[model samples]
Target chain A: MSGNILEVSGLTKTVGGGKKIVDGLSFDMKKGEILGLLGPNGAGKTTTIRMIVGLMSKTDGSVTINGRDLDEQGKACRANIGAIVENPTFYEYMSGYKNLKLWGRMAGGSVTEERISEVVSLVKLEDAIKDKVKKYSLGMKQRLGVAQAILHRPSLLILDEPTNGLDPKGIRELRDYLRELADEGISTLVSSHLLSEMQLMCDRVVIMEKGKVIDISDLSSLNAYGDKDQVAVSISVKKGQGEAAKTAVSVLEEVTVASHETENELLLDMGRDRIPELNRVLVKAGIDVFGIESKRTSLEEKFLQLTSGKADKEAN
Target chain B: MFALLHNEWSKLWNKKQPWIFIGILIVISIGTAFLYTAFDTLEGAGTEGDGENWEVTLELENEQYAQTIAESDDEWEREFAQDRIEENEALLAAGVDPNETNNAVFLNEMIYVGTAFITLFAVILASTIVSSEQDKGTLKHLFVRPYERWQFLVAKFITVILFAAVMLVTVTAVQYLMGTIMFGTGSFSTPVVEYGMGGVITTTVAEVFPQKIGLYFLNMLMFVVISFSISILFKSQTLAVGIGIFILFGTNILQGFAPLLQDYFWYPYVFLPHMTLQSYVVTDEFIPGVGLGFSLAVLAVYAVLFLGAATAFFQKRDLV
Candidate 1:
């Protein structure tokens, strides 16, 4: 990652009734990076994003986007950003093209008709662009939201659950589209509670719990805790072979073996360097070895461990 | 700013609400024309004798009293005086006579009444222009755009004024055509201004031209500012419209008796003598020696203050 494109420090928002929804939250997103904000309900992710976009005022703290203070130069700062704060409300009575055209004007660029048509095609809404937005399906609306956010080619894009209501196919399309955007050097921040999807899309993830940032880590770092560094070797053996397998496993130092009577087998977890030693020990012990395999940790296991395990519970 | 203006302009022209308002105005025009036409035909030859006509009853009472004064017998004189007193009482019970004297006067009165109805549309239209976005949650989408808050508000304000102007002209045109065809294209009977002995002055009904333009434009502007201020204050279209209509009507009624509060400390500021555009139209008293110029200046100040507050509040508001 390059230098940070968006930095929020000590952000707090105490709503009207004296409740602090977001307190002391801080995070940094680097250039051309895709950061996912993962949180449960009432975790203050939306509130923090609103404040950053200048839609909701911060109770105390600062937000800088592309090195410009959000408060000091709000217009200048927001000019470089585009956000889809929630479900992306649009003028429902207006046609899709008209809605984008109106917002594209407000986005303030050299937004030509050609550029608008290009965006329409980019979102894959070319056939339906002339239809009123009220008639659009939820998936279509989601795409339209993406189209509007990226219309001006803003450097920093913020989406709150951009795929909140999409089906399987739409979600995959959105994933690819977001990846393409990041590849084009646009920094994006996407918020979602879909952990697996986030793991797949984000270069890094920031998980919040109860109004604070609980963890911020790259995908590799999150994997470190749950990854499998040992290789497994399964060997077929004769009936009444438990004692023999145990003796055989004992020969390979630092190998842990467990026997299953029903299958008449031994399962071994050993380091890559010890695989040959285990084979020699098994052969010396006169046990027939079937196969050896290595399995890496899946993202689902890493996500659950990172989000639900004691490491985060204790940190929070 | 220009882009915001263009967006607002398109919303105003293409929305269903403005067309609905225009449709309402059309219905009102047709209704007013029918009501006035029926009244004119019934009072055929301008005899002013229809029992339903309140102004006619007052005129008859005055004539009866003149005849009663010419009698000589004491009992007869007393009896005639009692008859005259009874007639006067009957006339008063019919309520204040609306000034529908002739076709010209009636048309002018219709314009005044139409102004009130049109004010409702202006207030609601302007308030909704800003507050509806907030209510519908569309404002968040708008706020995240590059446009400044003040520019957005100004564009909304301009759209409201243009909407109000179109409604005003449509109603005025319909009334003008009906009034001309029915009233024989007569020159205005009342003078623009009248001067009594020793430079004492009296206003009349004839000066409705430029003064009508002034009153309608000024009142429209005032209503726009008022609606916009309330819209920003409440951030709700329904409340803004309701409160605006109540204040518009309430202030007029209160100002009718405002001269009674001349001894109070707050009379000058509460002096809302502006509903009677005819008083301004006829007497040149709207500004007295200074004329319409002074009246316009005072109105401008109110407009600026309210619109400025709207700008300030909108800019500072958290887009919920």
Candidate 2:
């Protein structure tokens, strides 16, 4: 009765030559929480979700659902979860409704006729619900994927890249549906490489880099996280005074010269507030300041810097 | 387990392949009956007694067969004549009409023939039943449910066995209908002729067919088990199906090699020779003392081994 619907601790997966593709991932989801797993490609989000849902075996560590250990009570543990691993594929020869009934039957036969129609129309699939899945477009298939994941009203919903191949409207509708489900006290774990989407959909986000959780943070300062940790504020004094600019900024306590981008421009690794401090030193040194320009504020660039480790250390 | 079985059964009937398989079976059953009727008059005229004087006609055919056996030097032709002569003498001694072809006779003969098609379709069905789910990317969805991996597999195994049984029942029913339409229904107790190690044997359809169909059904169950195991264990669907069909037809080819290989100590243990367990009904022994019990035992051992490997592999396999 921890009230955490899903708990994963030190979960690891190793491939050939003992390479840990997913290493030491520990996270927990509370009741009615919308937790997003945010990582770049190859961050092991799918691998972790697969292990939690029993699609793949874990080489080490444990996953517990609804206070039930996965090893001791796997069926009971899985009964609490509904997942769409990677992309959802259905029995294409069957109608969408029949496919739902098939999945509903597999969930210990508790899904009712009313629940079937409720999920169908909840996903707005009532129009083509009787048609074969083969005829449904990618967007329709995505919607049906949502329908099947919620058919049994599982307490834990795991969707790996559920927004893949979805339009903007579809994505928005899915976000709204997830919020509605969250209002009903069903915890959901959604993984995506898209940071903005995660920011919009998740109540909390766990950022991963290189098969490990680099940082866990709320939505407010995540944009700030990208900026502060990046190699920002590349300064260009006089063409000849680049050397002097480096010499003058050496007086500062926490400055490190990041890179020598050009003969005249010295890329400085320091916080944004210290830009004026270095400017004062350069002016005192009697060097003509050509210009002090920080790198452009693109989130993806900052994210790359974040995953590449510079932003992480700054945040820590 | 029942819920899993219901899910699998629903998914199976939702496809088109099983329906097409049963459709072809009905057409073949009806078509073969009409084809047999086209040559019925020729066969009646050859005996010179039609259907009513079947006992007298057997005597005339036996006299003609004796002359043919004496004049023929080719081994097959001589054996054929000698065999028919023994069959006629056995039927006459038993007072059973040899020329009575009716619903019971048609059913007895055609049930095994239709099951050959059943065996083929069942092998194909079992081969693709699991691997097709893998190919279609729906397998991972099943893995996430509130059931063990082995439960899904066992459900599929039972489904295929059920499918093969349903095909057998349906094919027999359709063949019986066609038989009644063409030749009329005869006594289920009508005597039929069979060749055995001790010469021709006389038995009734009622006395013989239960054993035949029962043995056939058991043998067909082994076929389904083998193919279903191979389907789950192997990665490639086409290769799984190819090996399944190869094993199905390969049993007959192995029958040709049985006599040569019988001297080997391991020959009896190999499952191929035992695949035709129905053959043991007429002959008391396949060779000297090997019989239905030995074949059944060998098949049971093999079925356990095949399914053991499949279940072990399926339980540990990580669906990527």
Question: Residues B48-99, candidate 1, lDDT per residue (tens digit)?
Answer: 5554775666666667766666654577776767665554554354343332
Score residue A179 of candidate 2 by CA lDDT.
95
**Candidate 2 C-alpha lDDT tens digits along A9-120:** 9999998899998999998888999999888777888888888988889999998899999989999988888889988999999999999999998877689999999999
Q: B184 in model 1: Cα distance from truth in Å?
A: 5.4
Tens digits of lDDT, candidate 1, A1-316: 2378999899999987988899899999999999988876677888888888888889998899888889898888788787888787878888889899898888765678888898889889999999999999999988999898889888999998887778989989989888899999999999887777787788898888777887786875444433335555566666666577677688666777744545567666666566667667767888765654543344444545655764333422
Off by over 4 Å in 2: A223-302, A309-316, B69-77, B196-198
TM score of chain A per candidate: 0.79, 0.74
* Colliding residue pairs in candidate 1: B203-B282, B203-B283, B204-B282
Per-residue lDDT value at B226 in model 2: 85
What does candidate 1 score in Cα RMSD to the true structure?
A: 7.0
